[model samples]
Target: MRATAEPAIAVTRQLGRFIATSSWLDIPVDVRREARRTLVHWIACAIGGSTHDTVERAVRAQLAMSNHGNARLFGRRERLVPASAALVNGIASHVLDFDDTQLGATNVHPTGPVASALFALAEIRPLSGAALAHALVLGIEVECRLANAVFRHANRGWHVTGAVGSLGAAAACAKALALEEQQIAFALGTAATQVVGLREMFGSMCKSLHTGRAADNGLTAAMLAAEGYTSADAAVEGPQGYAQVLNGATDLAGVVGALGQRYEISRLSYKPYACGVVMHPTIEACLRAREARPDLSARATAITLRVHPDVLSATGKQSPRTGLETKFSVYHAAAVALVHGIAGEDAFSDAMAVDPHVSAVRGRVRAQPDEAVRKDEVHATFSLPGETIEEHIDHVVGSVTRPMTDADLERKFESLAGEVLGASRCGRLLERCRGFEEISDAREVLAAATA
Candidate 1:
């Protein structure tokens, strides 16, 4: 009777090696299909967010920094360095605060890292739709697995997208390059050194900067590894390594377990509101209540929101005065939803935040955390003229249970794309995204989106 041995660190390293080089033929059909969907969604987000001042500024600034390279800028005609382009485009995709969100991993935005890396590589390698699709799947798996491994650790203070996403981004870049298993491992180890971000800066520009830095670091890691740059093989598991020094709990075994079989990216939730995901349900509840009784919110004495503890961490402003601040204010979001009966991108503008009526109501609104409401759901109650009406939203529109309809997604695209390309180009871009998987040339999709 011999005792069985536990899986070694070598096994985890092997899994990382396998993931970086796995091709379309290696993954299942369903994973491949889901990958295409994720890519289309990522493109949609980038196109929609291109109109943001921050995104536009960042892209323009990066363009000035480097004049060489062939990587395509989202919603623009010029090309920049692969790494720089990814950083700018990744930030643009998330700059407006409208992007895909994973339910299980509250703070991880998959497209920011994966799409950023893939598009950067695609410009250089001219990857096929199938190859590009597979890369996205592999990238997503890496991001989500790292997300799972570090989410609890992230909850303590680490920004997983910054810390773990750098590694994911490198993994994606290695896949796109079709690197050898050993090279891929080297890339991962190189990426490990660059992982860094703090959740304390969630409400400001630095929040999105995390995504940008991760995108840049990840691509740089792969490119450096490809050129024979070296990193410690024990980058993840060694004492003072990624798991120990950075996150304090990286769960290497969990990250590598079921590497090819389980897919975590397909479970992500799309966002309807261009604000923090935590505030979405509260915004929706206010909208519903307003529609049900319009006058109630108009004359409300006070409003109260019951939400999970993370809301305050993600988007809770006790007293906010600016438009950018409103994006992270549940009170302001609720006020906008009630006053305008919607929480679109316009609702988060500085003008709207300072509106007499919105400000008046926002002053009276209060938010408190409740153990009963999960981080993804919320319970909001409005105290109006005659009564206190309550609504508990388990799933907001664009969330898993109440997913956004095609029409809803189109509406979001129209609002953002219209700001830059005008109505004609916007309409064409939306059409291409709906049928993106069938396209043979990735340029067709990019051209249609930026036209």
Candidate 2:
């Protein structure tokens, strides 16, 4: 007989121990470099999205709930309690749906929950840059591992970012606070029990709420555990535990096998377009097709896309009526990419969604699911008056295989944040993020990020 697998509880304990014991020196150099990149990308997103209508509404809602604390909001000059700060900043970072994504074990947005919770805590306390980076990596590890163990959680209708993100936030907060192993375990338990997010809420204000709540819930969990709050030690793998209750089964071995040997941050992918990652290939194909044949849009009678089934399942909205819904519509992505030649934040607005020309083009676009097509690859065929132009994208630009370089990331940051912080301040903030480890207080970085 084959040997039995380890219990889910073992995974939780191993993760807690690793977070409690690991230091900056324990992290690999490449992982550390990626951690900084992740932080900078997240901060830029948070700042750039701060002035968004969604963020404005969230901030207003949070302010109504509590108006007493001193944690800074990125890109905006507002103060809330650590938990509220985490909540609002998390929402802001993800409102545009442009945050960095990790596509290795799970497709969770790794930076939002972890960075939001950590920065909130840093503002309340005085955490050094090294400590903050270490915690950020540890936090991502815990959440991404949990995501790997429950790999199909998203397919099951849970937004994995919010579902697994709370645990990541808890881990990062616990590490930043220097929690003991037991405390860290308790923090995980608290976070695991309170996982929040559902795919039904996607493409709405509620979707951003999931990320905000994950950050808030995890920060709260860590704070509670730090005060000696007790929780189930086997919260992750126990009977009726997080994995069993939420996912029916868990890959405990996958969660614990390479605890510190490999870091999940290394598998991160930054989005070049402000839409679902699955739609990127289609957008790239459309853009490339447009570039090769500039008159393709005017000449094309129909556009057909062959893509992975998951692409349509995730982003198949035919007539997206709102900006938020447009982010999930692959048809809109393709249409805009072909018509406007760009799918940046400016391309996914309510106004852009309702544009007659864009609608005309998107109406002609059809996506057919093909299991043979890889998720990162797409085949787009544009039928003109007589001729057909075909574009095949085997590797999407933002995938790990074709990653955005540091300079590419900086350009993306400048484009997004320059509007909010102006060109000079955005430049300064980028420098600060690149040298985050040398900072004495992590809050200084947060301060510089704001307008």
Give lDDT tens digits, candidate 2, residues 1-451.
Answer: 7365446347678878888888788898999999988888898889888998988988888889888978999999889888999999999999999998875335789789999999999987789998999999989988887888786444578888999999999999999999999999999999999999988887898888888899999999999999999888788987668987887765577777777899888988999999888999999999899888887777799999999888887798999999999999999999999889988998999999999999999989999999899878999899987688889999899889999999999998898888899999988888888999999999888888876
Q: Per-residue error at 444 for model 2, in Å?
A: 0.8
lDDT of 1 by residue, 284-315 (tens): 88888888888866688988899987888777
lDDT of each: 0.75, 0.88
TM-score of each: 0.91, 0.97
lDDT of 1 at 280: 88
CA RMSD for every model?
3.4, 2.3
Model 1 residue 92 lDDT? 75
